[model samples]
Target: MLLAMDRVTSYYGKTAILKDFSFGIEEGKCLCVLGRNGVGKTTLMRTIMGLTDRSIGDITIKGTEIGSSPTHVRAKLGIGYVPQGRGILSEFTVRENILLGTFARHDGRPDIPEVCLQMFPYLKANLDRRAGLLSGGQKQQLAIARALAVDPKILLLDEPTEGIQPNIVHEIGETLMTLNRKLGITLLLTEQHIRVARRLGDAFLMVDNGRVVASGPMAQLTDDVIHHYLTI
Candidate 1:
């Protein structure tokens, strides 16, 4: 497995969120995490990235245990996280924001910029524009571009298409598929779009109340399961 979480549990201060959640993804596959709002989807992503400290369990990337590693160490260890809301700096230019991702990463993959530009052409043209000034979709592109700048082994995305328009959402899906197929980057996506998930995911994980209620291949998404926990 390229990335694996075994019996992972997390907390927000005192309240527990995830309980013994476990999942895995290969080097070049995309694993989509699906559920309705406040279902521990974001918590799973955060826990994997060490943004929220894990109360129990283990997270291993490429066979190395990273349960205690900080966020910066995880980034250097090849985990690129694009958190919810596409948190791009509104006051900083596109190039500046992308540079932020390359900061902690010292590997210096020379082709990073080229690959990111290929995935998101809008950022190529507006390299000097302030990120906050861009449209919602453009900001999303920047957020993803920044994460890619790190040359990650696995890309962890939290609701990349949350509030974007339909056209932009489709565009994001296409980019993700291309990256997964062409660049061989494993994608762990937490999203609410079942339509998009069905199209791009090789496997799926469904959570409810911070627990892995069900998981399997996208082809195995039975109607009963979707209606039971996925649909609100």
Candidate 2:
């Protein structure tokens, strides 16, 4: 397994968010995490990256015990995260934001990977453009590009298609699919769009009230599962 969580619980401050959550994803598969708003979908991602205030239980990446490791250590272990809200620094240039990901690389090299430039031509052309000046879709592209800069074995995406233009939603979805399928990068995506999840994911985990309520191969995620756990 590329990623595994066993009875993991996470909290923000004194309040509990994810409770005894457990799931695993193979080395090259995409796992879609689904839930209604405020159901700890984001928390689950944060917990894996060691961002929560505290967490207990096992979180293994490639058979290594990372449950107690710090966030930077986890990143160096090849976990890349594109957080919710496209957490790019507005003050930085497009190139600078991408360079930040390289900090986690073991080589300690500061050069931006050529793949990042090749993947997003717009960013390559606008290397010096301030990140705050980009559109929603552009910012999202940059976010993904930054995570890719980490040269990760697995990518954790929190609502990668959120709040973007309808046409660009499809474009972003396609980009992620190419990364997961063609490039062989593993994906752990928290997504609200059923269509996107169905297209990109090999398996699904439906989280509700901070626990895994339903999970299986993508073929088994029927309309009933959608209505019960996904729909508002």
What lDDT does candidate 1 reach at residue 183? 87
Runs in model 2 lying further than 4 Å from the true structure: none
Once model 1 is optimally superposed onto the true structure by TM-score, how far is the C-alpha of residue 153 displaced, in angstroms?
A: 0.6
TM-score of each: 0.96, 0.98
Tens digits of per-residue lDDT for model 2, 1-232:
8899999999999888999999999998999999999999999999999999999899999999998999999999999999999899999999999999999876677899998898899999999999999999999999999998888999999999999998999999999988998999999999989999999999999999999999999999999999998767
Number of the top lDDT candidate:
2
lDDT of 1 by residue, 1-232 (tens): 9999899889888888998888888889999998888989998988888878446888999899998988899899988989998888889999989888886565765444688888787789889988888999888889988999888888999999999999999999998888898888899999888899999999999999889888898999888888998666
Model 1 alpha-carbon miss at residue 146, Å: 0.1
Worst 10 residues of 1 by lDDT: 103-112
In the order shown, the candidates' Cα RMSDs to the true structure are 1.4, 0.7
> All candidates' lDDT scores?
0.87, 0.94
